[model samples]
Target: MISGLDDVIAAETMLSDVDGLNGRLVIAGHSLDDLAGRTSYEAMLALLLGEFLQADTAAITRNLAAARREVHAYVEGIDAAILALSPIEALRAMIARLPDGEDRDTAYRLLAAPAVFTPALLRMQQGLPVIAPSETLGHAADMLAMLLGTVPAEEQAKALDTYLVTVSDHGLNASTFAARVVASTRAGLTSAILAALSALKGPLHGGAPGPVLDMLDSVGTPERAEAVLAAELARGERLMGFGHRIYRVRDPRADALKAALQQLAKAGAVPAGRLALAEAVEGAALVLLRQKKPDRALETNVEFYTALLLEALGLPREAFTCVFAAGRVGGWIGHAREQIDHGRLIRPQSKYIGPLAA
Candidate 1:
């Protein structure tokens, strides 16, 4: 058996493809770069949910936003009490309150819940009140506006859109797999999303970005990057953001986000030397890591620059995963709907090696 179930092809999907060897990603029929800054989040959701969502685009957008507003108000009512909970815990609580059902309307509400809960959890971490959703705004833009209390500038907005789109879906990731499993059981959308969120909260899955910041902080400056990385390697510590499970080459999302970060830096939104320093650190770490572990292909993954980009966007380290959930919730809902339509329970057989019974 493959350890950790490596190279296991469990299911077929029309969602995003992760081509690890070529460092490429395709969402639906479009290349990630083609769709990143070009389409709005709602439009991308439409593309992913085509034929599966039964609702018209206008209805979907309106109902999703309305659901966000409803969840936002609900979270605000308990903001003080849940502030003591971790962001993921608060997010789970918020998701748990969504109305339960498998109807189209319930699907729309489930689709919007994570977008509302994640940002609210992040803001609550900073002692800020949750911002209500705006009917006048698109989902990604509204998320940024809510987090900052003002609309983001054009470049910032575009950057967030790109980041969100690039990560919208990947085939059978742990969280997506969990979502599909739940949906296969004919569970409601809320239950499917809660399963996905629970999987995402695991460190081995969606919890790498915050550690990227910790790595950057320990390195302190560009001059120390190589030495610190070398020492970490010597100590047998895995560099937090340098590798991925699927990507044998570099992660395509890394370049997508790095491009957005460069745009932000050019627009003077991020500090001048910050991107350069990060690039240096990444390059040095890659070279040194290759020399040290010849058998392992440790290329830079998305989390390396995801942290810098979100941090540059003024998000705290604690909020990185929550922001990830914000972008990924759309994909989760789409996948859940797809699994439900496919009409099968996802109960895979497991090989047991623990004990033998007579």
Candidate 2:
């Protein structure tokens, strides 16, 4: 059997394609560049859901707004112990409690859960009052408002909207695969999305952005970047933002987010020094990686700028993956529907090599 199912073409999907060799990501017949920052998050959702959504972008916007308000019910009256868990864990615990269904609304509701639940849990963890959701604002603006208790600046909201669109879908990555496997069981949308969240919690998948910030904090200055990266390389530690498993060249998502972060920096949203330090670290890490590895093309990937962008938007590092989930849930729902309509049981066979049983 192929280890980790490498090079396996398990599903035929029209949702998204990751052209790893070319370092391009296509979502619903459009390149990631074509969609990032250019399309609204609701527009990206409509594009991904396709016929399942009846070509109605307005319906999704309404459903997500309503669902964001609805999911607040999950945050109230919870155990104090559960409230004290990290934001991601608490958000996951709360989301899994959502009522399951296979209706179109079910997909819409689950898609809104991370956007709504993450900010509430974050405020609670930080000893701040949870701001209620706004039914009138668009998804990104409403989410930022709910978290920070005021409307977000247009640039801030636009940056987050770009991030959401850029990451909405990629090929059959691990969490998406987990989502489809659960979908193959004829499970409801809630169950399938919960399965995706479980996989996303792993450090290798959706957990690196937090550490990218950690590395930046540790490095602190642009002038020290090369030395710090050299020490990390000498110790054989994997650089957090320098490599990707799929993209042999630079991750296109990295460029998308970096562009957003640059825009935010130009608007004076992010501290100037940190952005400069991050850029320096990125250049130093790329040079050192090529020198050390020689064979593998380990270029900058998504988590590098993801940390800076989310940090600029005032999200805590602990809550990074939840924000990622907020973007990715739409993709998960699309894959689940595809699997349900067109996939088989998803059970793969394995061979035993440990001496034959008597």
- Models 1 onward score TM values of 0.94, 0.98
lDDT of 1 by residue, 1-358 (tens): 7886678877677877888888889988888878877877777777887566755567567767887776676675655667787877777877788787777667667667767777777776777776888987777777787888788888888888788887889878999989988888887888988999899988898888999889887888899999999999899898989888888888888888888898999899998677767877888898998899889888988898889999988888777777788788778887887788774897768889887887
* Best candidate, lDDT: 2
Location of the lowest summed lDDT over 10 successive residues in candidate 2: 73-82
Pairs clashing within candidate 1 = none
Model 1 alpha-carbon drift over 4 Å, by segment = 55-60
> lDDT by residue for model 2 over 1-358, one digit each (tens)?
7888899899999999898899999999999988888888999999999589775678878878888888778778556887888777887788878888777778877988988888888888778899888888889988899899899999999999998998898889999999999999988889999989889999999988999999999898999999998999999998898788889888999999999998999999999999989989999998999899999989999999999999999999999999999999989999999999999889988887899778
Top candidate (TM-score):
2
